[model samples]
Target: MKGKRVALLALFAAVLAAVAIEPAAAQSGADSTTEKLIWDLNNQLMYIAVPITVLVEAILFYTVWKFKNNESPLPTRENRRLEITWTVATAVILLFVGVASYQVLAEPYVTATGADAGVDTVAEDEEILDVQVTAQKYNWQFNYPEQGVTNANTLVLPTDRPVRLNVTSTDWLHAFHVPGMGLKTDAFPGQSNYLLTKPTDTGEYQLYCAEYCGVGHSQMLGTVEVRSQDEFQSWLAENGDSGGDTASGNETAGNETGALSP
Candidate 1:
């Protein structure tokens, strides 16, 4: 009896340890809504599944130890109630997860746009900022069509406004992912992809080419600077409306400071 109790305690401890393990680190979101939804989904799924996993493992271990080395194994009778209980429980858990996933997918702020956002879209509303993204071998370029300014390596945007990035690749396939902003979109040659996000907080966030491309894969890193509306406008005025040459040029060799997106 003492040995059985010890075995049960060890099994329970093992289950608890498994449940306590933390998940992979996720990037902090730029907006409150996106951040809340992500954390809520993570917490809800863990709450629903952890207990079930613990219970199932505990029962299995207990049964294994209880029956081990028995001189005559007793005939087991099938229990209809046990079967029905597990089946219903599993269905209920899955149903809950499916509903939650749908809710996350339906959120407009996180979804990608299908069509290219134009000046008309921006003129209809000043709140929308359109930044065009072009991805190359190991670099990224950000162009403001409305402002008529182009930047290489660094992307600058205004906080408290919805920004749409129309992304395309010049060569090779790449994935544009900014973990901090909870944005990821694939960049294909000759095809454009769109990503939408609202920057609530003002700061520099890390951007990377999530897809493996070439020799400079690890060096493909960039920064996104989110500034206030007035500051952003001032920056546009300072940089002027001319779409200048990108960082790849020999003239701008020393100034090349950022990465590609999309």
Candidate 2:
């Protein structure tokens, strides 16, 4: 019994250690302001959660070990002081969580308020690019209204500039999610949702449809290419007016069926 108990405790400790380390290992290097904010919030919560989890589990295990062999267990007695202390502590923890989450969500780049607000929350001096995102069964269409450039399965953005994505769907519900940049917004038919992000790194990030739309949901994937301003402008000049003259005119005409290169 002693050996078994020791083994059980050791196993529990190992599990807790794995749980504590997994988040750090799984966290990707943040490449945008939104991502950084989310990561910071996660770390903040973990700082509170990890210690509480360990302490609670430790108390549970100790109580079980201490009382396991009690032949005549004493009647349970309620301690009002202990109960009140825990209640207050829990309230404080919840308050911290609520305030921290609100701070992130209230940011303009995090969650845009109002319908068709566009990039109104962005700083006056900052440059903003508008991209129209249309979602279909299993693919994505990106249209740069100002540049008159349309592309399928690939969203090209410039680094260090705010990009306002006006997202909507042509058919069913879908969600535009870019995990690396921490951008996600729902795409509803006949209604536009907006997301704002400024890419800090020049790289390719995976774009996924977070909401399951149909059987092809798993295949609904795209790429977000972040480039330097000069490179993006050159590419835009080359691709603009090649086809897809208007944002709504060529929804199904230009490369809409094209799949992202693996």
Candidate 3:
């Protein structure tokens, strides 16, 4: 019994330590409004979850410690009050999770679907840059439909402005993920998925294909370069025609499965 008690205490301590260290480890270096929102949501959930976890673990440990020596323990009596209390608490927690998740998912910058397709709801006066993202076996292509510019393996966007990414896969299914910006969406073949975000900082962020495609899945990596509006416009003008041809040629040569062109 003493050994069991010691093990339980150690487990309780480990749980507490894990809860304490989770926030720091979970940080993704959010640098955009949508990313910040996601970060905030994670913290919110942690705040709620930590306390409940502690409470439940504490009760479990206490019960074990208190009843450990009872060799001829009596049958437990049912307590309606305790039962009702826990049931209500569980319902409330579930409700909170549902509402919080829905709030984040329903945001225009997080997801734009149904009747809100192609609509810029982030700001009325702000201009939204539309970029089409195409994923193949081992590469990514970002095309600015309005500017008639395209780039391979690198996505460029203007800071402080909303960006709409129409993501799709040319061959196999892939996922477009920018961890720093909290942007992730499935890129299905023949279907375009929209993801919206506003960059709050000017820096290079890492992009990855979150799904497994083929032998080259590990190499299916990309970069997101966020720059000032003026610099972004300059880059568009410089690469408007040349960039498209270069990206097309590179993709055509690199494509092993003969996927459809972006």
Against the true structure, whose TM-score is highest? 3
Candidates' C-alpha lDDT: 0.73, 0.80, 0.82
Model 3: weakest 10-residue lDDT segment is 253-262
lDDT winner, 1 or 3: 3
Off by over 4 Å in 2: 1-27, 114-121, 243-262
- Candidates in descending TM-score order: 3, 2, 1
**Local accuracy of candidate 1 as per-residue lDDT tens digits, 137-250:** 677888898888888778998987778888898888888888877778888999989876668888888889999887667767778898998999998987764448543352
**TM-score, candidate number 3:** 0.83
Candidate RMSDs in Å, in order, are: 5.7, 5.7, 4.8
Off by over 4 Å in 3: 1-29, 114-120, 256-262
User: Mind giving the per-residue lDDT tens digits that candidate 3 earns over 41-89?
Assistant: 8877877777666666767877787899999999879999999998999
Q: Which pairs of residues have clashing backbones in candidate 2?
A: none
Model 1's lDDT to the true fold?
0.73
Model 2 Cα lDDT, one tens digit per residue, 1-262 = 9657755765677567758766784666678778877887887787677767766776677779888999899987999999999999999999999999999888767887644443566678987888999998778889888887888778989998888889999888999999889999899999988877788889999999999887667878889999999999998988887735443444443334323322
TM-score of every candidate: 0.76, 0.81, 0.83
Model 1: which ten-residue window has the lowest total lDDT? 250-259
